[model samples]
Target: MRDPWVRGLRYLKGNLFSCPPQEALAHCISEDCRMGAGIAVLFKKQFGGVSDLKAQNKKTGDCAVLRRHNRFVYYLITKKKASQKPTYESLKQSLVAMKTHCWENSVASISIPRIGCGLDRLSWEKVSVIIEEVFRDSNIRITVYSL
Candidate 1:
């Protein structure tokens, strides 16, 4: 894949869901999982639904990928356990995997929060750099949202 134009990527200060509808919603999650709070709850309500996500999470392990209600939702594992903090390496690996998945699925546009920077306690500066490194060459539009 050729390098995507830097200008193709965007950063906006607003609710992630408020942006124009995209093909996918991406976010960080832990291996010891629960879509209980924060944005996860909204995702559960909007896309995955409780029982379906719980079952999928159990069957798929850490990186749970599901298509629901005509949208793709990804739960990328950034930490091994709930009590642990998210690791930069794990985040990077997941982002790379996500890039590959997006390419395979022809997902031209995606919206993601500042993954690993909130409750997971990872640094946004580092995570943002990793996102660029992983997706900069992919012909995909990425929107990073802040709320």
Candidate 2:
């Protein structure tokens, strides 16, 4: 279970994907759950009433921070879950997936906030381990941000 990335791969949506770091706003819905009334409303506003048709294929998109930087970069890769309380191992594995994305993009330095804390409702300590473990053996450098 220590290999959070591997475990996540097994469970993260079959069509898992990532986009290069860029500036854009995207809409999302939990494939794991039917769109609630609240989420549907937001989705419609995001895609011009497409929520009623329910045709969005990409959910939980990658969001880059607005802070301007030369080399260093940041991204928010959203994950879908019915509930916020996921096992530590799963959350760790999820971060591993994100770390892979960063590496693929030739990102040498990374700054990710306290993942699984905002809506995921995870503890910072455990989240740190998930992040630290992902980049520890790799060549890329990383710094995690949190409250």
Best by TM-score: 1
Clashing pairs in 2: 4-93, 5-93
In order, the Cα lDDT scores of the candidates are 0.72, 0.41
Model 1 spans with C-alpha error above 4 angstroms: 1-8, 49-62
TM-score of each predicted structure versus truth: 0.82, 0.45
Off by over 4 Å in 2: 1-79, 82-84
Over 17-92, each residue of candidate 1 has an lDDT whose tens digit, in order, gives: 7766556888876665665666767766677554554565532224567786566778887776666776788788
* TM match of model 2 to true structure: 0.45
Q: Considering every candidate listed, which one attains the maximal lDDT?
A: 1
Mark the 10 consecutive residues where model 2 has the least summed lDDT. 8-17
Over 1-147, each residue of candidate 2 has an lDDT whose tens digit, in order, gives 442243221112221112223322222224343434433233333334333223433334333222222332222334454443445665554456555665666655553344556455668666666666666777654433323
